[model samples]
Target chain A: MGRRIAQIICFAFGALLFALYFSQHPTARSLNTAVMIDYWQIIFAITLLVGVISFVRINLSNIRRGDNRPYRIISLVGLAVMPILAIIWGIKGNSPFMWMFEYVQVPMQSTVFALLAFFVASASFRGFRARSAPAAVLLTAALLTLTSRSSLEGIVPQFITEAADWVRGNPSMAARRAILIGIGLGSLTTSLRVILGIERTWLGSDK
Target chain B: MDWGVIIAGLLTLAIFSFLYRDNPAYKMAESLLIGVSIGYFLVITWTNTLMDLLFVPLTQDAKWPLIIPLALGVMMFGRFHKRTAPLSRIPIAVLIGSGAGVAIPAMLEARTLRQISATVGPLVTESGLPDISLIAVLVGVLTTLVYFYFSREHKGALGGAAKVGTYFLMSFFGTTFGYTVMSRMSTLIGRVEFLLSDFLRLTQ
Candidate 1:
């Protein structure tokens, strides 16, 4: 009875919300969803506690085992302190949460991304070599767009920019539309799998 | 010069250290990032999807109508248990039925018809100087489609078409690579700005 109840609730709600999302009504569909999403944002906020607990357990155990003492200590402290300060002071305005997010997390994520630029340069120099006929045409189109986008327009003439406009507007847009159609079909299929319970693997390891 | 900048710089070094050797610092940062993300999302889904989709609607809107589906979702959880789990079938079947209903039309329309329609356009172009764009599209559609045609040896007419298709592929790759490079460069620029403006007592 309980199990049946859960499944019914999941489907009915999923369907209703899905329909509501598509509907024109601002209140019955959109606003209700926005409110629910806001309420559910609590879970991620609360996950900070779960993260700290798990980190402390793992790092403390690592230290006790004399394995990775120094790095473990760093994780242990960072996990413990930042959230406590943020929670006590509140996250908005001039709080520790806002400070740590802006300074630390934001920079780290950005720096990691910055490093990806080096990878792209290396890949372009090495991986983009045309071993076939079709590859050559693709390379030509790619080079046009790349030069157009980059700061190289000052050195290269205006003709390249015109060619890029032709490629992007007509051929590329057509391909993109075709790809979007495929993606839409793919997503619809996946949603169906989940709804039918054919894709219950998301429920986790058991069934 | 500031302590905060020093630490961030070190963190950068620690992370980038993987280029040479597998350092403990890099591993720690990577693992923490993964663990935190996973834990965070699990909590998020429980609240966002489960609570909102399964709980609130049943409570606030329809009462008994929700009971059957809720029972199905519960049966899903039963897979975790050893017995009585066969009860999961009723919900699972209904889900499959509904899924097929929703997907069949969408897949047929979007994937089959619309996709084909997008490829189907005039052989000529408005600019019309040999219509390289049209030629490119025609060749791309023919050869790339032929690249899949696999029944015959790719030597004569089809082989030549597929050969031009290679140029199409290369240009596609090159564009993707360039965009990726620009995106990364922007990230690097942002980080540098943060370090310069926020951490250091320097330029705003």
Candidate 2:
């Protein structure tokens, strides 16, 4: 009974929204905007809070089990501190919340992203071996792109940049376009399946 | 003293410490990052999303239709318990269904139709010169699509086209990697600049 209701709601909303896309009426447009913007955001926000609760519960259990207790405690502290700070100081300019975001969160986020450079370089060193024709093409293209983009761009011959630009414009663009087309078709099919109730995987049960 | 810069620099170093070896500092920094990010998002969602969108409009403007989504959002909390878990499915279904519905037309127009139109442009330029790049792109697209078509066995003409497609795919991957590395390197340089100029006061 519960599953049937859920499926009905899913099909109803999905079919309604999909049908709404084709309409030029003002009411349809407003309905689409309201649901897509307001309703979606509200639901998504609540879902995120649910996720955070789950995360906290898991971490708390881990801490209780003495699984890296100190680090887990520090993590919980960080989690608890942000909301408290926001509540006390608000999230306005010069507020402690903004201060933590600017100083602590942003820096760590960027550093983590930056850290990927080392891993990428190391992976490339091991993986960029040109043992076959396709591998050679990959290596050549990578080198051309890297050299053209690097500080050595001025010192390198003009043809290198031209070749890199050509590769990016032609073959690379084609590959990406093909992949995009494939993705579009796949998404369309999957969406149809979901709306039609053919895809029940999201229901989280076979029964 | 600029405590902001000091704290940021120390945390940045702690993250970078993983390059040497994973230690307590790195673990602590990683855990803190996860926790703080969740908290930050939670606050933003509350203020920017819930309070501004739902509460304000529902109370002041009397936009009663907002209650539908509000009820759905509340239903998401049902997931916390075992018996009430099934109730969460309705909201999840609504989100997924609507999202999928929107995605159908959106993906078709943006990803499929536009890309095909772009790819199938004139092979010859206005000046009457044979556009080698366009020809190459046409071939690349066709061959790449052929490579993805798995129903047919790779033999004869299909094999050759698929082989060429692999080269194009590899070139695409390589170019993407190059760009990714460059972006990461730029971020790394910015961190180094911050450490030297802002934190250490070594540079102008």
Candidate 3:
């Protein structure tokens, strides 16, 4: 019974929004934007709260079980302190919250992202092995591209760069468009499925 | 002797230490990052989204229609209770449905229609010679589409075309991977620069 009602709401809202996008009517457009910008924003914000609560609950349970208790405590403290600092001192540029964010979060994030460079190098070593004909082509193309786009361009011939550009302009672009068109068609089909209530995976199980 | 820069430098080093092996410093730094990120998100979302968008407008402007979505949002918490878990589907459905609804038409216009038009252009050059690049692009697009087409068995000519298409696809992916490596290297370079110039003060 509840599932039926949920399906109806999904269909109604989905169809309304889908139709709303195509409508040239000012009222429909404004209403769609209002629903998205205002209502959906709040819903997504509320979902974040849900996420935080789940995080805290899981960490607290972990702490209780003595699974990495010290680390869990640090995580909890970090979580607790920032909001209190934000509320009490406010998040002015000089506030403790902002200070922690700037000094801690930014550096950590940048360093983590920087680690991807090492991983990519390792992956490329494995990927550009030229184990087969197709792989040889891939390896050759990748090597040419990397050399052309790198500081080694001075050493590499200008023709290498020109060939790389040609590859990017024609083959790469065509493949990209084909993939894009596939995605567009797939998305449209999925949207129709959702509207028609044929797709119920989002509902989870009755369990 | 700014404390912030010193702390930033230490955290940066601690995070990079994971490249050697996972240690207490890296774990602590990782946990601190996760917690701080969530905390920061919560505060920002509360202020910029909830208070400014929902609460303020409702309280000050008396925009009562906002309550419908608010109620739906609140209903998402029903998942916390076993019996009421099914009720959470209402919000989930609304979110997925609306998201898909909004995406489809825009995707059609941008990815499908625009792409087709972009591909279908004048094959002749300004000097009246047939543009080889344009012809190559047209052939590439059609053959690649054929490569993805599962309806027919690739036995003869279709197999030959699909084989060529596979090379084009491989070239595309290889270039993309190469570009990714360059960008990632750039990111690493930025961190190195920060460490040297700002943290260690080794260079200007």
Candidate 4:
């Protein structure tokens, strides 16, 4: 019964918002803005708390099980410390909170992504075996692209760069657009299914 | 001179150390990253969204309508408890439903219609010359679409066309991969520069 009501509520809100997009009524516009801006913001904030709770729960379990307890403790401590510091000291641009963010979080995130550089280079060399015609074409395109973008652009002839541009603009873009079209249509179908309650996967099997 | 630069350099080295092999430093840095990111988001959400948007409006402006979302938000925490887990589904459903509804129209307009319109243009440029690149794009798009059309058996001319489409798709993927590598390399360069210039004072 509860799940049924939840699904109904979900359908109603979705339909209402969908209708609002098409409608120009003043009341609907105000409600739409309020729901999206004010209401959604709060809801999203509450969702973040849910994430923090889950993190704590899992890390605590790990610690209790004696599985890398020290690292788990470090994680929990790091998690707990920043928010406490922020709330107590505030997170202005020059505050300790922002300092920790700029130093620790910023570098860590960037370095994490940066680590992909070595992996990509190694992986491409290992993976780009030209066993087939399509594979050969792919390898050629990749090489041309890298060379066109690198310092070798000056060393390589201008015509090669033009060819690289043509390849990127034509074939690459067409494939990308085809994929995008597929994704758009698929999303529309899935959204309609959810709105009409045809998709019940969101409703857990607990009931 | 600055502590921030020192800490950042150390963290960068810690993460890069994973290139050698997974070690304790990498593990610690990874954990710290997750913890700090979540913590940062938590505080930002509390101050920026909760205090500013919800609490202030409800208390000061007396926006009674805000209570509806507040109640729903509190109910989201019910998932942790066994009996109320079903109740939590309500908010999750509304979130998913509304998200899908919003995404559907936006994606259709942006991704599908606009892309198709862009793809459909004259084969010749204003200079009255045959636009070779445009022709290539049109042919690539059609063949790629045909390749994706799996309702019918791919044989004869269709099979040949699909083979051509496979090459186009592979070339596209390759270029995309190269571009991604370039982006990642730029980030790595930035970190290396920071270490040399800011932390080690090796270069100005």
Candidate 5:
């Protein structure tokens, strides 16, 4: 009895909403879907508060278990202070929330980015190995690209410019277009899944 | 001397102190940052999205249309419970069924059919050999597709084609690596510039 009702409701609502999007005529189906999308967003907003509660609960439990976690307390303090300050003052161009964003978020992101240098160095070392004919060609192109002393020399030797331009225009363009095509397909598939609700893995469950 | 710059400058120094060695100040800043981000997302969703989009409209008018997603969203919370979790299928089925229905035509047109059509054009023209760029594109498309073909072992003609694919992949990866390195260097430079230009102002 329970599952029958669930299936009936699910199929009817899903089909109606899906069809609404394709309809040329003004219909209740389209209007209902538009409203439902907005309401779903509100439910997601409530989940944010739930997330904060979860965070505090987990960290507090960790501290209680003799973890000696002072950093968790620091987190709670910032969480408490910033929201209160923002609520009191309200966020605008020069408000405290904006202040925290510019000062805090940007710096931390930059720090994580600094680690990329080390990773790139190691990856490049592996990539530049002249182990095969293709590797040799890669090494030569990379050397030319790396060593080029901008203005006058390329003008002096037409062939150098022509060769460099050829490498950039042909092989590089092809490679990049291939990448773009793959990305476009992947994104299109993802968007399709989202709109259809077929890809509910993002919801962390069947729902 | 400005208070905005001073607080930011101090925070930057505290955060970056990890470069020398990890310590209390860095840990404190990092924790505060994580906590603030959680709070910020919550507040943004409440004010910018929820209050504007859902809460006001639902209350002002009896938004019966919203009842479906609201029910679906509630069903999603069922996963938290042990026994009632199977009830989550209602929402999941709705999501999957609708999502697939909408995406089917779009994906067919945009990704599969468009790509197949793109490959069907003339390979060689009267102007000369087919456009060199087009030839490289065809090679890349053919080779990469072949590279992903796992059914047959790379031997004989397959081996030669696979070899070309491997080279294309490596060169593609190599160029990507260079671009990533340059971008990372720029990030570091930008951070240092921010510290000097926005925070300190003494370097100028």
Candidate 6:
């Protein structure tokens, strides 16, 4: 019963939105904007709340089980503290919430991303072997691109940068364009399948 | 005392400690990062999305249409329990359905039609000389598409084209990797600069 109603709602909304795209009428445009902007944001925000709740629940269970209890407790503390701070001091510029964000979240986040550089370099060293003809071509292209972007551009011959630019503009662009077209066609078919009820994977179960 | 610099610098070093080996410091920093990031996003979403978009409009302006999404959003909470879990599907359906609907026309126009039109133009120059670069691009596109087409057994001419396609794909992958590494290195440089200039006061 629930599944059928869900499917009906999905089809109705999908069809309405699709039809709305073709219409240039003021009412149609406004309705489309309202759904896309206002309703979408509201639902998305609620969905995020639901996710945070699940995160808390999972951490609580882990703590109860004594699996990495200290780490889990720290996580829970961090989670709990942010909202408390926000409620007390508010999220304005000089608030405790913003302070935590600037000092804690932003620094750690960027450092984590920056850490990827080491792994990528290590991975490339191990994996970027030019044993075959195609691999050699790939290596050359990579070297050209890297050098062109790096400090070596000033020292390297002018032809190297020109070659890299050509590779980027011509061959790279062509492959990307083909992939994009393929993605578009694939998306169109999948969307049609979804709207037509041919795809039920998102419904979580066939039953 | 500059507590911000001290706190941020310590956290950054704790994360960087993973390079030596995963220790207690790294684990704690990682845990705190995950929790704090989620918390930050939660607050932002509440302030920028829920309060501003849903609550303010609904309460102050009395926009009754927002009640529908609010109810749908509430329905999402049904997932917390087993029996009521299926009720969450309704809202999920709406999100997925509308997303797919919007994507169809957008994808077709931007990705397929535009790309095709762009690719299928002006193979020759105005002076009647052959434009080799344009020719190469056309061939690259056709061959790449052929490589992706799995309907037939790749033999004879198809095999040849597919082989050529692999070269173009390899070039694309190589350039992409180069760009990714460049960006990551830039981020690493930024962190180093922050540590030296902002935290340690070693460089200006």
Looking at chain B only, the TM-scores across the models are 0.72, 0.96, 0.93, 0.91, 0.82, 0.97
Of the true interface contacts, each candidate retains a share of: 0.23, 0.84, 0.76, 0.78, 0.36, 0.79
Quote model 1's TM-score for chain B.
Answer: 0.72
What lDDT, from 0 to 1, does candidate 1 have? 0.58
Worst 10 residues of 4 chain B by lDDT: B96-105
Off by over 4 Å in 4: B125-129
Question: How high is the CA lDDT of each candidate model?
Answer: 0.58, 0.93, 0.87, 0.88, 0.65, 0.91
Candidate 3 residue runs with Cα over 4 Å from true position: A153-155
Mind giving the per-residue lDDT tens digits that candidate 3 earns over A1-207?
888888888888888898999888999988898877877898899888888888999999999999999999888888998899999999887888898888888888989999989988887777668888878778777887899999898999889999988988888888887888888888889888988989888777787
Model 1 ranges with Cα > 4 A deviation: A1-69, B1-3, B17-20, B24-169, B189-204
Better of 1 and 2 by TM-score: 2
RMSD in angstroms between candidate 4 and the native structure over all alpha carbons: 1.8
Candidate 6 residue pairs in backbone clash? none
For the predicted complex of model 6, DockQ is 0.83
Cα lDDT tens digits, model 6, A1-207, are 888888888888888889999999999999899887887889999999999999999999999999999989889889888988998999998999999999999999999999999999999899899999999888888898999999789999999999999998999888888899899999999998888899988999734
lDDT per residue for candidate 2 within A1-207, as digits (tens), equals 888998998899899999999999999999999989999999999899899889889999999899999999988999999999999999999999999999999999999999999999999889889999999988888888899999989999999999999999999888998999999989999999999999989989633
Model 4: clashing residue pairs? none
lDDT of 1 by residue, B45-139 (tens): 55556567656776877644445445545545544347865555544444443444445555667665776676666766667656666665655
Comparing 2 with 4 on lDDT, the higher-scoring candidate is: 2
TM-score, predicted candidate 5 vs. hidden true structure:
0.77
- Residues A97-203 of candidate 5: C-alpha lDDT, one tens digit per residue: 87777767667767657646656676778766888888876775554444343434445466765665566655654555455556556656665555544544543
Task: List, in order, the clash count of every candidate structure.
Answer: 38, 0, 0, 0, 6, 0
List A-chain TM-scores for all predictions. 0.77, 0.96, 0.94, 0.93, 0.61, 0.96
Best by DockQ: 2
lDDT of 5 at B93: 57
lDDT string, candidate 3, B27-142, tens digits: 99999888888888899899899999889889999989889778878988887889988878888878887887787788889978998899999999999999999888888888
Top candidate when judged by lDDT against the true structure: 2
Per-residue lDDT of candidate 5, residues B57-168 (tens digit): 6788776666666666666666567677766666665654454445555555675566656655677878867766667767866676566566899888877887777666
